[model samples]
Target chain A: MSQKAHDIFFRSNAPVTVDEDKCIAHKGCTVCVEVCPMDLLAINPLTQKAYMQFDECWYCMPCETDCPTGAVKVEIPYLLR
Target chain B: MSLDNFLNLEQEYDIVVIGGGTAGPMAAIKAKERNPNLRILLLDKANVKRSGAISMGMDGLNNAVIPGHATPEQYTREITIANDGIVNQATVYAYAKHSFTTIEQLDRWGVKFEKDGTGDYAVKKVHHMGSYVLPMPEGHDIKKVLYRQLKRAKIAITNRIVSTRLLTDASGAVCGVLGFDCRSADFHIIKAKAVILCCGAAGRLGLPASGYLMGTYENPTNAGDGYAMAYHAGAELANLECFQINPLIKDYNGPACAYVTGPLGGYTANNKGNRFIECDYWSGQMMWEFYQELQGGNGPVFLKLDHLAEETIQTIEHILHSNERPSRGQFHANRNTDYRHKMVEMHISEIGFCSGHSASGVWVNERAETSVPGLYSAGDMAAVPHNYMLGAFTYGWFAGHSAADYVAGKEFSALDKEQIAREKQRVYAPLLREHGLPPAQVEYKLRRFVNDYLQPPKVTRKMELALERFDQIEEDIAQLKAANPHELMRAMEVAVIRDCAEMAARASLFRQESRWGLYHHRVDFPERDDANWFYHCHLKKDQSGRMVSHKREVEPYLIPLDDHERNAYDKLRLKAANG
Candidate 1:
């Protein structure tokens, strides 16, 4: 998809990771997978950590907003503009 | 990525307003109306067309205009009730009384509201107030109204842009702002008399959340830009706690807009499929009341929704005159569009949404002035006394008018050349090379902690654990070095994530009695402490970047509700009492 076609606020092929320190492992953070608009993140039930779906992402704040423990983060490439 | 773009920063303007949302645009319009010759520059990190609660086309406006459905007094009552009474009474009235006027002002600005078959403006919107929530329809499409005014004002609209930071004099009062063109990444300096920080509340997770197997992203640009700018410029911040949550978002997640649940008649249902609002501590009365249900073990509660009634869907279709998901009148589109029959299963499918139902921000005086001398905040950026954001309307009006006036009244001071050079170095320092911290790793951790742990109502111990974990995660932020513009922008997201964690920690630490919204579960202090804990747990920032807690007494506006309005609230309460 054209970058302009998507909301300028989001980025595709952006790096996605989770903070291990903040993860309480309540096992309730499944909303990320369920609501992944880009299908960018996956869960490793064995390791209990999420993996990235680098090929697809719309870069919205739902998963970040929904996390109860303040866990999710988003980093998009932006310049001085 | 190029040195050429760094040369894009220009030095001056007539007016520079910080945010580009409902309040910012309104402020820009107000300033233009006052001075046509003024060079007005309105900027946001994203396009103005898609920023803020209104621009995102979340839910319809909930203006407290009519005395019948919700008198300003009654509205204030509701706000105080929701806040457990910590709202500044004068602050509530200032915004509550003006909501009616704001609605009318929006109409005067040429934005159209949904009209009834009789061609009169509709007073009651569908699915509001009670089960229907059918109260006064306070117009629709806030973005349309503001946009019309912006165009008529002939204000320079820098839609896709960035509010990089603020420019201040040695004395530490705001002089202008630093911004960049979204497409070109061109640095633009907007010199103005006063600056208003309406860059709405922080929410960007520099990283994806760890715990959530997966979920939709919440806000794309709300990485606490206002808070960071204010803090860097030495502005006092407040209410870092009291973050909001639906508790039901995971149950029936879809649509990035808030209020999506309301129109769908979505409610919280526990693992047993029983309506948990009444059963759990959370009140089933308003949709927000469901937060208590899940917090109190009513969840792991999945949301239960009846899907749009087939004919109601058709009626919406008839009104919109199109078959699009968001009807031309997009007020309730989020609710009606998703054809999911069950709410719990819906959560398993779609991403999360946004709503003004809950959230906290910096504290502001009636003039919307922050603790900082020359800085001001409005809309979601300002820490409101309560959740209704009564001041968002008035505060925006005040901030724009006041900030413009402050600029007009002041004399322009020349840049201390040495200081300017120092600031320039600061801005580019991150771009020089790569720090040990990777942007993705920092972002990933920040996202997981905030969205997964902070938003849900878990136990005190679990919450404390979340807070401690956040502290350690934030440590990695310092090591993040931006090698390029994108990296710098994402690196700046650290400020946003830090503030998010601060607010979440505060929300967990305070509010021993989780009475309302998503903060309902309590293994420690398990019951509602209306007598002792019914006030707001406010947060202010310390010099150390840690949150300082304060208790704002929740006081009621003692005015009697209008006869008819009182009767309406009484009816709702009467049902509760009888039950």
Candidate 2:
């Protein structure tokens, strides 16, 4: 195939953040990940801590509200903020 | 990425309910209750535990026709006037009569409602005429309550499957569904005797003013998937031009929620801190006045609660912060806005299709049956004007029982191999291609065009241009690439959004006259032409697979509304000077 198409990346900040010290993802807690309607959060494999994988947060705040521990924080997406 | 390499899973069900949101869960549970032997499957793109519009749960029922507070006839009349008389009165009346029963059912299921000292249901007056706003102070766990009911009713649920299309048999009746898992990229070919669509509003059709794609008033996950699927299945969609435009908190895009706070003494006011409209009901007329206030140099409307007592402010905060978009409290705090000190700034939201707020959705009858047999619709997606959460539950009960009766002794039709194969190829094409356009970028561009041309104060020429742009976006959709299953779900949604954009433009162009306040406001046709455009404008896919638009006669009124009652919503603006 010709080099007619190539993927380009753009930098964007994830509005949702998880506190490493408070996150219990390592202890098999995926409450935040499971409850996110957008499926934006995930457990980082290397650290086994919950983190936002995708920048597409609705700011509806299910992850933060349903987090087993108070580790998750959802900010207004930067464009809106 | 050949078809042979992919895993295909086939499931058999008596009925499949798409969208495990407010209505889908109710439909599934009620169907199982109606006929325990029937196997029902309830699915959602997100987890059933937290899905759809009420993901974080709602603050109050906007239209709860509880007895003693309001009669079914009165509520029906109110909605008829609010929708500018383009409603199927039988559907509205049916929802009205069953409203109390639905509320009682929720009460029995552990959902709490505010009550007075006399133990009466404390329904508040918020509509232009009736007292319908019933507050749910502890409504944050409404989904949890519904989930418990689902388990008790023995209803099966599959979460994280994004339904793409409805499969129809040779006779053109819906028989099954086609979708893929958003995480595993596995195909779900569900064969069903009946399919109930409860997919909430076409929320992601227009770009929010903030330019954030996901910061939509409706759950961004909705993306008009139900509207697109119903159109493809040849179901008629009513009043697509009557868009859902709400007065939301500026930048935050969620409802400033006058319905919740209005009964507690908060009112929508202009920047001068004076009330402009007489009523806080979210009718199109009320929004027209709101739009006038914003554009007429008295810009930036606010939810005025600053004059309330300190205790009242705290009480407002407790209920508003804890339920229905709880990030609201944080949003206020981030801006240093407090109900006691500063009024929350409000702005007009971008347009979308939602019968829950405005009249634009899949056309269904009193029994929740669409034009296509065996296909039922309910909730925000179904065309029941002003049918909020309570109506969702009521219509859902109707759909469930109707579908339960529909599936009795009805054998599943033979699956179309060609349809399934074609859908499989279309679904996996993005993943098969090495490189192409991204779904998010495509969606953003499409929605931007929707706002540009389709957002009302609509012009004939701009809408024509929008059709042209939407065609180009259709071409762009063919080149979309998805790296994984999650992006693939979004890629499919872009196509859905494009379909809705075209539908919105076509429906607006077909109407030719302005009616529903700012919703169908045509710059060219500024007058409400009830003489010619009194009927409902419906859109659907014709026999040739071409999108077509036409008019349907409005059903004769079940309960007659006097001339004064018919014009009630038109007088929402206060005749007195601003105070």
Q: Which candidate should be chosen as best, given lDDT against the real structure? A: 2
The lDDT values for all models are 0.52, 0.91
DockQ, candidate no. 1: 0.03
iRMSD for each candidate structure, in the order shown? 14.6, 1.0
Per-prediction count of colliding residue pairs?
Answer: 85, 0
Index of the highest-DockQ prediction: 2
Over A1-81, each residue of candidate 2 has an lDDT whose tens digit, in order, gives 655855678898878989999999999998998888888888899999999988899988889888888999989888777
Top model number, TM-score: 2
Q: Please state the error at residue B24 of candidate 1 in Å.
A: 1.2
lDDT of residue B534 for candidate 2: 94
Candidate 2: where are CA atoms >4 Å away?
A1-5, B577-579
Predicted structure 2: lDDT = 0.91
**CAPRI band for model 2:** medium
